[model samples]
Structure formats: C-alpha cells, structure tokens
Target: MKINLRKSLICINQQKLIAIFLVFMFLGFTLAKPEFASSYSINNILCTMALYGIASLGMTLVILTGGTDLSAGSVMALSGVIGAGLLGKAFSAANPVSLPFAATVLIALIFSGLIGYLNGIVITKLKIAPFVATLAMMSIARGLVYVVADSVVQGVSGSPITFMNDGYSLLGQGKIGAVPVQFIVYVILFLIVFVFLKYTRTGRSIYTVGGNIDTAKLAGIKTNKIIVLTYTVSSILVGISGLILVGRLSSASTVAAKGYELDFITAVALGGTSVAGGRGSVIGTLLGTAFLAVLNNGLDIVNVKSFYQYLIKGLILVFAVCADLFMNKRVKKS
Candidate 1:
C-alpha cells in the first residue's frame, strides 16, 4: 500500500515540481537584478512567452505523438512572407497582389496545413521516419521562403517585406488593460487545446497512438489519420504564430523565425513531456515556456553573452531529456 501510494504521489508531484522550480528561478533572478521585477520587463517576458508559447503548444502536440517538426520555423517564415506579401499595402513594391487581412491569413494557414499534410503523408505512406521526413520538409520550406520572396519582391530577393497596417499590427501589439492581446490569445489557445486533449475522442487516440502504435492499430484506431491530424493542427498553430510575429515587427524577412524550432522543442522537453511519447500535458508546457521566457529575459537583464545563453539552454535541454528518461524508467518499474 505504501509503494502504491508512493507511485501515485510521484505521478501527481511531477508538475508541481516544475512549478516550484520555476518560482525559485524567478525569485533568484529577481534577487540578482532588481529591475527584473519591473512591469516593463514582466510584460516583455509575457510577450516573448506568447510568441513562442503558441508554437510550443503545437510542438507539444507533435512530440506527444512521438514526432518532431523541424519545419516549424521554416513554416513560420513561409507563412509570414506569404501573408505579408499578399496584404494590400505598398510594403513590397514588386508584389502587385493585395488582399483583405482575413483572406491573406486564410491563404497562409491553408498553405501551412498543406505542408503538414504532406509531412504526415510522407511519414505514413512512404514509411519514412518523422525525423527524416520533417528534415526534408524543413529544407523545402526554407527554400520556398526564398523563392516566394523572390517572386513577390522581385529584385530584392532576400530583403524583408516591410508593411504598415494598423489592423494587422494590433494582433501583436495591442493591449487590453494591462495585458497584451497576444498573451490573451495564447491563454485562450492553451485552454482550448487542454480541453481538446482531455475530453475529445481523437485527442485520447493521439495518446494511444503515441503510447503504442501497434496496439492502437489493433484497437481499431486509424493511427494514420490521428498522426496526420496532429501534424496539420501543429502547422496551423505555427502559422498563427508566424502572422503574430509579422504583425509585431511590421516586416517579414526571408529569414524570419530561423532556428526557432529548437526553442519550441526545448520548451516542450523542459515542460516534462516525454520524448518517447504518451505522457505529458499542456499545463506542463505552459509552465516550461514561462520558465524559459524568464530565464532568457533574466539573462539579458544581467548582460549575459548570447553564446553563453546558447550553451546554457543546450545544457538544460540535455538535462531535461536525461531526467525524462530516468522518470520513464521509474514509472515502468513501479
């Protein structure tokens, strides 16, 4: 009875452990730099959290299915360039296309979803590993960024597409009272995903697919469809993030969101999600993203060099993966 109780306690306390660590880290940062607690800095952290957190949520979904998306950053860039290029503005002098904001956003999301669908089809139909398949898509999407930029902006093949649109900008920069609109959107998305994963039939099937593909298949679940659906949803969320980024910057560069995939994966891993799949939560991911946002902002506040920041984040990722492996072993033993 004691051992059984201990096992249940372990399961319950994992998320709390992360939350406690986050609080301690926040306190430590505040002590090291007094200004770290300032409202401006806090708001900055929340904004960063929202920007990356939205994509990380999608990443959480992908990882939960024992898959990874190397193309997310590229997809984000693609979406941004595509959306910005299509806007009815004089941003890109070479591009003659102009569309309403809603149309532009819809078109961008559709393309993103298509890319994700192809990824899933390749993984399922071609029997390619997710890593290899997504790696290929990453290259393809990035190359398309350059291609799209060249086609739209003509002579300035690689230049950023700068635009001025107040309505679009509001998505990233507007605030409701003291809170940012983007952050609010992030929260809404988080709650929606949480409810979906916890309450929906398809959501539960994702877990079963990730936990044991063969068993899921035997249980009469269409594993392929579930995988495809998760990937599609992941890309669409990433597309939304891309649009928000463009709004915030008022520009979309060919290199926008470059290498951001690492940050998303790191956030999901640090949040206690299993790389092996089948055990994790969006709540854990939210906490993990908060921890990362604080760490980055705090590091900048203390004037830490970018190189060292990279090293520190890399170490944390390694540690998180190791810890996850250890926990999985313990759970199996119990």
Candidate 2:
C-alpha cells in the first residue's frame, strides 16, 4: 500500500508539472495580448490542431516501421479534390448534401488506403526505398489534384453540411456548448489509435517489423503484410484530414494541403519519433502536435510574423532532435 501510494504521488506530480508548464506557456502568450487568449481564439487554434493531429497519428505509425511518408500532403490534396468534385452539384443546394458528402468521404478514404497498400507492396516486394517510393507517389498524387481541379471552384457552396449553420455550424461550425466539432473528432481518433496500438496484436506487430524485419519474420509475423497495412491505415487518416479541411473551408483547391507532409513529419519528430524509424509513441506525437499548434496559436495571438513562425518551427524541431540524441547517448553510457 505504501509503495502504491508513493507511485500514485509520483504520477500525480508529473502530471501537475506538465500541466503547469503548458498552462503557463499559453498564459504567457495570452498575457501579451489579452484578446488573443479569448475563448473563441483558443477554440479556433484547437480546431486546426484536430485536423493535423489525426494526420500525425497515422504518420506516427508509418514512421514506427522504419519508414517515412512523404506523400501525406499529396494524399490529402487528392482526397479533398475527389470529395469536392463529387459535391459539385450538391454543394450549394438548399437541402442537406450528407448523402454525397458521405459517399465522397468514403471514396476518398478508400482511394488513399489503396494507394498506401500499393506503397507497401512496392517498397516491400519490389525492394524500393520507402522514401523514394513515397516521394514518387507524392508527385503523382499532387499532379492528379491539378488534373481534378483544373477548372477550379465554379459556384458550389462546397459546403458539405447545411442544416447545422445550414450544415456549416456543428461538426464544422457548430460547437457542442463551447467545443468545436473537429476538436471532438480529433480526440476520438487519438483515443482510438492510442488504444489500438497499445492493446492490439496487429498494432504491436508494427513495432516488431520495424525493430528488425528478419527477427519479426522468424517470429512468424507477416512483415510484408504488416508494412502494407500500416501504410494503408496512414493513408486513410490523411483522407479523413482532407475531408475535415474541406468541410471547414467550404471549398477545395488543387493546392490545398501543400507542405502538410513537412508539418506532419516535423510533428512526429518533435514527439520523439526517430526519423530513421522504429521509436515513437502516439501520446508523444500527439503532444508534439499540440506543442506545434500551441506555438503557432500563441505566436499568432502575439502578432508574430508568419515568417518568424516558420523559423521558429524549424528551430524547435532541431532542438527536439538534439535532445533525443543527448538522451540516447546518456542512456548508452549509463
């Protein structure tokens, strides 16, 4: 009982320390500009975090397999274009376009998932570098976006929902009392992925395959299949992020989600996922995502130039890597 009590106290202390640090950090920014800390402003920041967080969760899994995805942003663009095209006629209609919206999202998700599976196949069976393979896929996916959105937004509301704020309010624009719909969605995805990875056999296989392909294979794991499945799952998450972005914007362009892959990768790395692969935590990635989001949000509130934001983000990523290296060296020495 005494040991358990001491353990509980240590856990509580850690939680409080982290909470205090984060709270004060945000508070510092808010203090710089009181209005920036307003409820609505905070909500908007969190809303954007939702979209990126979901995408990062998927990317985190992929990186865990000693592989990285450069095609994530392109996948998001392609999915958005596909969904927008399908909503062409129904976009601006007075009635709810949930049917087409649902179908478009479904198709987009399935399409990306297929592409991910292909990535796995090409890398594992064809003996291609995951980086080179994903890079090629990125270019191809981005090109497809241009092809699909050639003409561009005609006159559609591009608005997927109309009933809640004409389908623009809740889930996208509508808040649950005070919370944003996207925020809730992101939380659900985070929890689900976190649990699935921590508790499931298939999910655990990812770490195994990533740790050592030969060892995993000898242990009777279908390494190739696992690799393919990981990519597919990651792609599906990108599709979901795309749909949310479109829903929020009420429009989609060929250029949407450009450079998102960098942000996704950076978030993963900041969360302690080794770029070389096979070491990361979903929770860490989530915290990393939040840290980035909060940084941007806080800076924006303080009126920092966008240019500065870019510079700062790059610096933070470097710092995270350095810290990771230092920790690794210390552990080795010990």
Candidate 3:
C-alpha cells in the first residue's frame, strides 16, 4: 500500500513535487546563507539555469526516445572550438582573422548536428547500442577538437583558443535590461521545442517509437527517422549551449564541457523523465534545471567543498533512478 500510494503520488504530481522541492530548497538555502538571496546571486543562478536548461531540454527529448547521448559534452566542446576558430580570433593569437559571427555559428551548428546524425546512423543502421555508439562518438569528437585546434594554432596542441569577440561575448554576458540574453534565448528555445513536441506529428512519432518501436513500425511511423531526428536535434541544442559557454568564458578548449553529461542526465532524471522512454515534458526539464542551478548556487554560497558536492549529486542521481524504477514497476504491474 505504501508503494502503491507513493507511485500514485508520483504519477499524479510529479511536476508538482519538483516545484515543491525547488521552493523548499530555495527557502532552505536562503535561510542557511542569507547572501544566497541577494540580487546578484539570483541573477547568477538564473544564468546558470539558462545554460544548463537549454541542454537539459535537448537531453529530455533524447531520453524520452529511449536513448541517451553521452557525447553531448564532447560535441559541445568540438562545436565551441570550431566557433572559436571561425568567429573569434583564429586559433592562434598571432593570425587573428575573424569571420562573420553568423557564419561561424551556422558552421558550428551544422558540424555538431552532423555528428549527431552519424551517431543516429550507427545506432539505427549498425544496430549498435546508444550507450556504446555515443561513448565512441564522445571520444572521437573530443580528439577531433584537439586535432582541429592544433591545426589552427600551429603550435598550441593542447592550449585553449582565446576568442573574446564582443559579439560572441554578448550572447552569454549581455543583458536585456536586467535579464540575461542567454536566459531570453533559452526561453525562446524552450517554447519552440515545447510546441514542436506537443503539436507535431513527428513529435508524436518520437513518443511512439520510444514506447515500443515494433508497435510504432506497425503503426507506420518511421521509427528510425524519428530516432535520428531526436539525436540530431539534441546535438544542435548542445551546439547552442557550447556557443553560449564559449561566449561566457571567452575561450574554447578541448577540455571544455567535460562531465556536463552527468549534470544533463541528472536534471532529466530528476525532472521525472523516464530513462525507459515515452514520458516527459520540456517544462519538467526546465524546473529540473532550475532545481540543480539553485542547489549548486546554494552549495557555493554556503562554502560546501567541491568533493562533497559531487558526492551529494551522485547520491541524488542514484535515488532518482531508483525512484524511477520503482514507479515504472508499479506502472507495469497496474
């Protein structure tokens, strides 16, 4: 009965639970460290939300389709490096020839999306597992970043490319009045993706495919195409995040975005997205993103050590996954 009741609550009030938890966390943090409630702190958390939220939205889509992209962080790094090489000063501080900002962004996105497309092909055509395929892609993409950066810099094999262009910086650092430009961009992207998932035939197909590919095929849905498109869309969103991160840091390195996949996956899982696929919402992901942003900020404000933070986050992920499994089992039994 306790399990049934817990499952009932989760099924009916998953988003509400997330919202309540976020509120409690905020309140608790504010009480613990009054500085956490400061305007600057609030703005910082919001910016972090925008950054992680955008990528988490993409992860939500892929997770909903019963697949995961471990390559997201590496893909972002590759895209950021490519963008730095193009729109910012050349990879070398010496040559320093910058291209049009729009063109550079366009090229980076295309390249990242292509990587995702290839990942999809390997999974669909070669019948490889999503985990193995994306893991291989992650290593390949990271290595490519080193190769590309070294080629551009001519001596900087492992050094970061510093590109502090005003236009690039504006994307991550600029404000519209008091609101971060990145946050505004994140909102726009979120709305667009939400609408697509809610209203489009292809979007519906994604859910069907994830739920049961054989059933989806029987229904005449192009399961392979849907899977591929989900991955491609995910990588494009990762590119957006990479571009913003590069703008924020004013540089790109092969090491950038390392371990970001953990954060993304954690946010998606906490948002109530089933790792088994076929159930999730973009809005839930936003809330989940906000929850982590606040948690991290709170920890920082309270001077929590980095090691403890990692431990806490890891434990939370385990708990979230266990909860998901329990809920899924209940659903199946019912």
- What TM-score against the true fold does each predicted structure earn? 0.93, 0.85, 0.91
Candidate 3 lDDT? 0.87
Q: How many pairs of residues in model 1 come into backbone collision?
A: 0
TM-score of 2: 0.85
Task: Order the numbered candidates by TM-score, best leading.
Answer: 1, 3, 2
lDDT of 2 at 149: 61
List ranges where model 1 is wrong by over 4 Å. Answer: 1-14, 90-92, 321-334
lDDT (10s digit) by residue, model 1, range 61-166? 9999999999999999999988888884745466668898889999999999888999899988898999999999999999998887777775756988788887
How far off is residue 228 in model 1, in Å? 0.7
TM-score of 3: 0.91
Go through the candidates in order and give the C-alpha RMSD of each one to the true structure.
Answer: 2.3, 4.8, 3.4
Tens digit of lDDT per residue, candidate 2, span 124-224?
Answer: 99989999999999999888777666533334322222121233224456577788888888899999989888899988888888888889999999999
Q: Of models 2 and 3, which has the larger TM-score?
A: 3
Where does candidate 3 stray beyond 4 Å? 1-12, 88-91, 94-97, 320-334
Q: Per-residue alpha-carbon lDDT of model 3 for 46-164, expressed as tens digits? A: 89998888888889988988999999999999999898887647535554556888888999999999999998999999989999999999999999999867766667477888866
Note the residue pairs that clash in candidate 3. Answer: none
1 versus 2: better lDDT goes to: 1
